[model samples]
Target: MSERAYGEELMSEKILFVDDDINILQAYKRQLRKQFDLHTAQGPEEALKLIADHHNFAVVVSDFSMPGMNGVEFLSEVKKISPNSVRIMLTGFANATNAINAVNEGNIFRFLAKPCAPEQLALSLHASIDQYHLITAEKELLEKTLSGSIKVMSQILSLVNPVAFSSTSRIKSYIKHMVETLNLPGKWRYELAAMLCELGYVTLPPETTSKILANQPLSSNEQTLFDAHPTVSASMLDHIPRLEEVAEMVRRQQSNFSDYTLTEESILADPSTLGGCMLKVALDFDRLINTGMSLPKAIQSMSNRRGVYYPRLLQCMESLSKVDRSMEIRPIYMKDLTVGMIADEDILTVNHMLLIAKGQEVNLPMLERLRSFAKTTHIIEPCRMRIP
Candidate 1:
């Protein structure tokens, strides 16, 4: 194959063409079949069904003069169904009103007049595919870079505010367990939100965090500051690319489900909001556990506050506690440290300085840092860590 043909083949080949006329659809298939993997639908309804069945179309080209739904309206729905797909409008009459609607309402990438040349249509389709690739590539890049930066920020917070960061780790573990038990989607976002949910505490006085976590009475001003941490954390993260959903989850993390009646079905309907509720429960449970309450007592205490937590969530916690109780801790040499392992106790040097805190989740960066520290100073062998 020629280089250009090879490139087109490698690009997004999936395309959808919607028109009420069978002849036009036939012509599209005849001309574009060799260059793209095409799907045709007689009308907007059929097009919607096709979209529902196959969700990964990279481009959707719709005829403007349809029976029930116009191309603009159909494309608007297409945007909701698959925002990354490039949209194009084909109309018999090229009017200013239709063109404006196509651009403004549908966010169409191209507006082509009917009876367009085969070559022109092919070019437009290729360009649309290119646009889709560009959009998805940028989105992937933004998500990865933003996620890494947040992870590093959380690691720094762990060092700076050990008390608050330690609580974050524990909550994160609980959320991981809960999400897995529920088999929910977007587990990464939930975990990330849990890790950084308490980031705002870095701005507050350490004493304030200590008092809040300990359930000690705080002065009016201190209580106000504590209440503002979620909003502060959200604001700090809102501008980072692709973190809007995570930021919103953090912003609502402190909400009480008691304010409104929400069933498991309703909460599960929106995973992001469900994540916020999960963070709330996990944080509260951790706070109770840290304040000298036993595991069973902590669960009982949160369970007693009926509307404060989603019942389904508390049930997941109960399940997690059983699994946690059955797990055993063992000593593993520092050289054998692996990611995802939790330190059962603090790893300290002969001089009694803290190396890694108890309950800190082992990760690559932590492992590398420990290895480097071992080079300069001595770390006791056979470190104790917990595993499930």
Candidate 2:
């Protein structure tokens, strides 16, 4: 492809070259600095330091033979830390085996023999840049296009079953805090799982969803249906491309911690399983709080459930309760309600019927519905709300 075909945007992506010899590194900079936004490091150590400091490096080229770390080892670290950056290895004839290992382990995009022509090296760099763009473009499509469509579907479902979706919003917040507390990776998957977790509630009758939101007892038949909702939700998500992992998390959300029994090392080995564990904790905690249990009491109750959750995940809840206690709760009139405020308690009618569930965020549709209800039925005014 022509240089112009790559576009100025793609051509501007940063490139890094690493060699143990400072002279070879300087020679690469002198030869190709004008053609690429190039940076050089004397060895693998300096290269890793640069990688840690910089956010956007489109290509990383390293010599195979280094003082401490070989090209394969360095590039393997790059794969873990900056998987999107295209990796290329340069090696002598004797180091060809290592170059091949780099391709297998480090996912190296291209490798060049030492003493290569400048033109051939430039061509390889251009190819790697094109490859980087392709990788990023696909990721953008998944994040923007696919996720956007899912969000639109979620909006529709929210309108249809606000009680279910509102509970989803509250659970999502808990999941977010847990993910942050644990310093988990692939947070977007957990977020999306939380967003879509309640989709199956849309299939139930409005009363069934209301009973669930109110934490009321369900008939055996209703309980059977309720237990199957995760399966239904997972089935829907499984059809979407690139969402298989998220689907698995949804499917396994109801799994008991005792059933899994993964060791600390094994718990992190499978991110989807960990994600499911987070969802279980969040969902049950939301249920407890909806039953009017205080944050501390709900966490205490969860701790009492011997096989329900991991102790560390339960500890995250304890820390989260500290944040919850610090938040200010105030009373607001129905007409004064606005979006983004969370309901501190269940909004109820004068006759003791639940109108809105606790922990539900105030949204435009909910606000309008409450207003219409007030015109016909008496609502408990000066309702309690929490400032997030």
Candidate 3:
């Protein structure tokens, strides 16, 4: 593999080396450039930008001492930016304390001393790449294969109880936006949790699902059933391999801010807690809007409920709502409905039976179902929708 600067096309190596010293970077290029595909960055800031643009790297090697940010700090940032990338620290002054800190805080895969032979560095790089492959392959299996099966099951369940799963797609979108807006790492876990958050709804009767979705006051018995959904969902997820963390997030979705003393700064450091808080915010926001509350009013209502939501997450939702409201809402006939359009109001049949809930994203199956219904039953025309 040829030695190239950042922003070049990725080759088989997918390896990055960051150091403040040009001499050291050049030396790496001179010695190990042929053995592996090499990319170089002068400092941590540049390396981070490169990772942001390029998306992923199999392995990242950084010098321990540098201007502004040290190796541990840089590697920590790398963990956020490219989590699948295996990190290694190579420095001239490696102490026991530094090693311990690097392992704990930075979560580095390996530590190497300076003046290391090319053969040793190459071996380390090979191991790091192998680790990267393991991480990504397992994620692929879960996301593609396992997640696909679960979604199909949810879709079938949605058919049985449309009211329960009506908001699943919308809730997933909300969580995805928050993850990006808040710059939270390990987004897949939260997104997968969002997808399966309503799995337990399948266990509820249609009447109970309707009450929960409508934000109606449930009876004591119904409320008990409602409260157990998160646990039921979490239990099901817990049985799956590599889903322990996602299960925990679903398990804690209904937890309140008063339950813990996490500050805004500290909350960012804990993804599991943050994931659960995000789920709560998304779920509650959806319920409020479904009750005919405006964007600002829904956010304000959530904020008024002290100790119920994480303050910063609510703020993020408010900001996202402003952006979402920019889309133009237009009236369209049933035939004009296409995929990805957001429903502005509940769609009902001629008999006043609810057909599609508000805030649901239009999908192909829904379109086909609507078409099939139009042939047999009369659906109210001129649906109010937000078209992008």
What are the lDDT scores of the predictions, listed in order? 0.82, 0.83, 0.84
Native-referenced Cα lDDT, model 2: 0.83
Model 3 regions more than 4 Å off: 1-58, 62-83, 87-114, 117-138, 321-332, 343-355, 376-388
lDDT tens readout by residue for model 1, 144-201: 7767787888877676555566566678789999988887645778888998898898
- lDDT per residue for candidate 2 within 1-388, as digits (tens), equals 5757555655579999999999998899899887888898889989898886664799999998898898889999988768789999888854657766877999989878889899999989989998998998988777887777776677666655556777767777788998888777557888889989877887777788878877899999889889999999999999888899999999988998888867855786477888889899998888887676888888888898898887888888888744443468999998888887778777888997766767677766677878888889999989999887
Best by lDDT: 3
Candidate 1 RMSD to the real structure: 4.9
Judged by lDDT relative to the true structure, which candidate is superior, 1 or 3? 3
The best candidate by TM-score is 1
The C-alpha TM-scores of every prediction are 0.74, 0.72, 0.73
Candidate 2 Cα outliers beyond 4 Å, as residue runs: 1-82, 94-107, 116-134, 204-219, 304-307, 321-327, 333-335, 344-356, 364-383
Q: How far is candidate 2 from the true structure (C-alpha RMSD, Å)?
A: 5.5
Model 1 alpha-carbon miss at residue 323, Å = 6.5
- Give the worst 10-residue stretch by lDDT in candidate 1: 319-328
User: 376 in model 1: Cα distance from truth in Å?
Assistant: 5.5
